[model samples]
Target: MDVSLGTVFVSEIMGTAMLLLLGGGVVANVILPKTKGFNSGWIVITFGWGLGVFAGVYAAYKSGAHLNFAVTIGLLANGAAEYAPGVAVTFASTMVYLAGEMVGAFLGAILVFLAYKKHFDEDADPGTKLAVFSTGPAVRNYGWNFVTEVIGTFVLVFIIIAFGKTPSGLGPLAVALLVVGIGLSLGGPTGYAINPNRDLGPRIAHALLPIKGKGSSDWGYAWVPVLGPIVGGAIAGLVATAYVV
Candidate 1:
């Protein structure tokens, strides 16, 4: 089936929105005190991210909803998508997809924020406050933090493309399992901000959202989630291609 540009854009938006809701919502629930999901732990994050993938993919499977930058670049690198037809079309469409994802991510964060607004106000730890928006290491360090994100994202895309076979075959249940495993195994280090849209969009939302004395958003570590996933996904796709070929 031929994919339409409009469909692609809408699917990306919807999928990303769901991702943010599941992922960012979990953070809000865990970090916010006296709430139901408060301190729910890594398992919750893993499950939430897994289900987020299922929900996003389910919503946008028809329109090539990738919901992750790494997947987008990997598809282009492997000639899976016709991104070479026209420069303007390719560039504009890709940027549009990213934009849609950011919007979706923001929407998800907003939902989580609203869901736990009262809790946010009640909570008073700076670290906890930051957790509601973006990820940070259990023990802070520059090198390991980047590595964790890279490894986590690499595993995520590899499974999605190879095991899950999304947008082609397989089902959400399997896709969700792949994510669950990644979260359980690789999510410990940096909370597994595997998708750029998933991290940056919600981070942006956190900055904009009114949360009373919300501390710095950790902009310095921002690029890790953004760049790490892209590089890791590219490598995984190349490796997959070599093996398959």
Candidate 2:
């Protein structure tokens, strides 16, 4: 219960690294030519991401598994005292989690690229390459894209809070299933980038990495996923706090 900030940072880094590794790996598998899982469809991606959450949560359970920055913000807003005993959720600890997540996300993207380096060279579409790292809107509409991210992330954090109330303590599995459900239902428009770090970190990696034929990072539409999730997560936290209390 009484965890040090160092412990929290290490745990989150390891957990989030795994989260992005598997999550990004799935996209690479689907989009990259010559890969075994190429063209596996959206269902594979949703399941892969769900499983990534499961693994990351288990890996970071000691740190409350706040793998996503949005989740961290939501949990704190909802009252960390209720869930994390003796673990002071201060500004410093928040920074630890954020730093860990960002670094882990970037590392994970690098690992994915390494794993599929040959396929990346074989693949010609920059959009497909970029999709492995970050998200893009199907129709490229910023207004609607922001709305979709808000709704999707609201469902994610809201349902996660609901799961916390259950006595069964379904833990990571429940959250993983929640992610899958969100993806299946609401992922169409913006690829369901419910986590800001999940998008930004890998996007940064894609930009930094020297992948041949890779296209623009699409910085113009990046703010929607980041800002929308923050807003949605904050709203969910406020709503959950009020409803629960």
Candidate 3:
């Protein structure tokens, strides 16, 4: 399972870019007017994200398919002991993973916006447009929103670690299903960001993009998605190390 840092960077960048492209693309499709999948609802969104994870993981499996920064952090924390020995989870590699994921996520959001350029112009709702790029709380309560994100991301990273014991081929599918389940069951509160890169990168893109009628990037609520998932992933990693390693 040894891979060079260069491979990790390239794979993470490519895979995470694809992940955001498809995942954000789905939100754009359902929310933006003139799109074929307009108003297709949450089920479609959950499936889209799951499929996005599937595609991203398949493309990045050579570097352990860590398209998510939270996942990479979780594995690094786990590797502190013996849970993931000889896996090259060094500080330098972690930085590379983080850098790649951030860039990829930003680029992916840009791709989605370009692909749906016509819809952005036609759509008049700023909230809906922003939704395509980032997650927002259904209730707008920061404390509760943070809790929901923590619980959702804990389930995500913990289950991913648990699934590592399964057959190699089943890993991608299993994790995808886990994402779908998280979205369906726990996503109602905060749209199930579950990964810091997935939310922040696109939110940054939303801020920078020149989409017509795009509203505030909601920078006020942005920290929850990023910090909650990292805290949750760290907790999952520590628990997994204590229990499994």
Best by TM-score: 2
lDDT (Cα, tens digit) per residue for candidate 3, span 69-108: 7887777676643222244556777788898889889999
Best by lDDT: 2
How far out, in Å, is residue 97 in model 2?
1.2
Name every residue pair that clashes in candidate 1.
none
Query: For each candidate, what is the lDDT?
Result: 0.73, 0.85, 0.84
Q: lDDT per residue, candidate 2, 1-245, as tens digits? A: 57777787787888888999999999899888999998989999999999998998888777778778888777777776633445677887778889988888889889999999999999468999999999999998899999999999888887777667321144888888988999999999999999999999999999999999998999999899899898888788888988865
Instruction: Provide the lowest-lDDT 10-residue window in model 2.
Output: 161-170
In candidate 1, where is summed lDDT lowest over 10 consecutive residues?
A: 80-89
lDDT of 1 by residue, 1-245 (tens): 66666667777788888877887777677667887877878788778878888888787775555778777666555545452222223666767767777778888888888887788888487668778778777777878788888788777666656753343244676777777898788877777777787888878887888887688888888888888888877777776666544
TM-scores of the models, in the given order? 0.89, 0.95, 0.94
Off by over 4 Å in 2: 165-170
Report clashes for each candidate as comma-separated counts: 0, 0, 0
Candidates 1 and 3, the one with greater lDDT: 3
Better structure of 1 and 3 per TM-score? 3
